[model samples]
Target: MVLAHAEHSGPRVLNIGEVLAQLSDDFPTMTASKIRFLEEKGLITPNRTPAGYRQYSENDVERLRFVLSLQRDQYLPLKVIKDYLDAIDRGERPENLPPGVKVSPRIVSDEFAAEMTGRVRALTEEQLRTESGASVPLLQSLLSFGLIQHSNGRFDEHALQVAKACVQLESHGLEPRHLRPFQAAAEREFGLVERAVSPLSSRRDAASQARAAEAAREISELCLTLHRALVQDRIARMDS
Candidate 1:
């Protein structure tokens, strides 16, 4: 049984995979990446083996469990959790962390936020059709082709933009049926992004989630830029 803030002087330590296996049964969302994130935030310092592997003591595990509990049960933001951990490290018994506190840490850069911001209001199907000049059949085609998405009973900004783009494409005789390859290519790109951020997304922390999101956006942007450049090169070759 793990005790809260349990201390141990023995040399027993667990590796990242072992730690995840041990904690996953309890904290189903726990991951090796999250453990690393906690270490990065100075919440729990594990020893390093001769081969540069992370070795966590029993106390470190307890501290990690404590911090994760605060996150899952209390919903305390990472900054608050770090402050509490700092207090504990100073040999101070900190008060109970408040529950359900909504704090947005500056986990994302301002430029990234600006680049990624979407329309705040969700549009219904009718509203989307009216705003994007897309007919019902076209909207349905977009939905069937997975070009638009609706989650929790709301169509998001991406769907709106896709509808508008499809409308414009129709004017140029590029039908929705011809756009399947674009969606498939996008999915492939997303697969690459997911693989790239596997280390960070493996963690379940707020900071990791935020960082992973930003990284995904940046990677996607890079992929789009590359695709555009390649298309431009093809156009130049055709002209030549």
Candidate 2:
């Protein structure tokens, strides 16, 4: 299990040799010297035991994996990768990820980390309908109502999610036309989020842009929670 923090009370820490053993399969060329060089370059910082032995947390291992993947796959220079890591450490999502490289969270299972760098498949219209189990008329309704959209004859994961949810709601007598208010409400909520993050977003620096994106994500989640709570509170009144 990956521990978020490197406290001794948490998961067992790996010595340098153990860390190499864990990573060697994917990075056979990796060595103690290379790891040390990375540390000198400010790429990673493993903890030191009482006797001066290097100890690495699971998060450190994942960070190393990310750094190595960027170097090998994207051929990114250490400076660029360091900047990306700095943004991530600050809880901001960097914008310069290569096409298929996804940076999973530090506290991820080994299996999950192994599968982290894959591409998101863009579904065709037929594939979206098949995967979502959305009927032709329902799909048409979703398209007309602006509940879902496609680009270049392709739909992304978000489109599929909206289609599937619309299918489920259709059974409960909620048609696409009846869901227009949701799209409007989403637009209004986005306006609020956009306005709140505008100062950060308007800045030209990569760090500022990343901060703006993170802020928007956080604000959007809060808005969703408030919307859900308000709806639930009204529904509870019917039980009184």
Candidate 3:
């Protein structure tokens, strides 16, 4: 469900002029021709009425805001902006998003977007145990089994998440040792992502670096989706 907010079924009530009226205060130079140009470039697809008039939804207006903000603030080229929008269309958060760029909640889950934009406070060992409801022995077992690690005496959001998952699994009779395969599988998947993005990563340009990061993020999300589907399929087979 985290990635399910990409589609919009809202009514497209704003005409092109209405959309321009809403945005022109912020993007003073925004014009009908510019909006049409973005559509021509495949960056946005506004709905069309039977009379051949363009109809823009609230989501469409927010999307235009995202695109224009990137252009005006970051000076990013349309191509790069298109890549970011494409990733959003696929329900992905683009990596290393420029600070303060607003994304539409309709296009991405707020929680997923916050993970990219917000910083998680590092948890102390006691804090981790309290927050995750993990016992000391279980935390020790997780660290011993290489399922989680603390860095510089601090556990991060990831460690907390893993600890919480392990606690839940423990209740189901699965222990830290039983979850080692997941760590290994994660490493293997990350390796595949690294290799896939190597070409873009090797480039020195800012745009290329951004592309590589986005590609890595997108690939990782896809890998997780595949893994989840496979696991679900296996579990479903138990009933058959």
Would you list the C-alpha lDDT of every candidate in the order shown?
0.70, 0.78, 0.80
lDDT of 3 by residue, 1-240 (tens): 222123455555788999999998999889999999988998778777789888777777877888888877777788778878776766455655665665666555566566445643568999999999999999999999988888798998779889999999999999998899999998999899999999989987565777777788789999999999999999999999
Q: Which candidate should be chosen as best, given TM-score against the real structure?
A: 2
Q: Regarding TM-score, does 1 or 3 come out ahead? A: 3
Segments in model 1 whose C-alpha atoms lie over 4 Å from true places: 1-120, 151-153
lDDT of 2 by residue, 1-240 (tens): 333332222477898898899999999999999999999998777788789888887777778898898888766678777766765554334554555667765634444344344443568989999999999999898999898988888897779989999889999999999999999999999999999999988986554665676678779999999999999999999999
When sorted by lDDT, best at the front, the candidate numbers are 3, 2, 1
TM-score attained by model 2 = 0.60
lDDT of 2: 0.78
* Model 1: per-residue Cα lDDT over 1-240, one tens digit each: 111222335656787887787788889888778888888887776777789987776667667777787777656677667765554454333333343332111221233223224224567888998999999999889888888888765786678889999999999999889999999998899999999998988887655654665577678899999999999999999988
Question: Which residue pairs collide, candidate 2?
Answer: none
Worst 10 residues of 2 by lDDT: 1-10
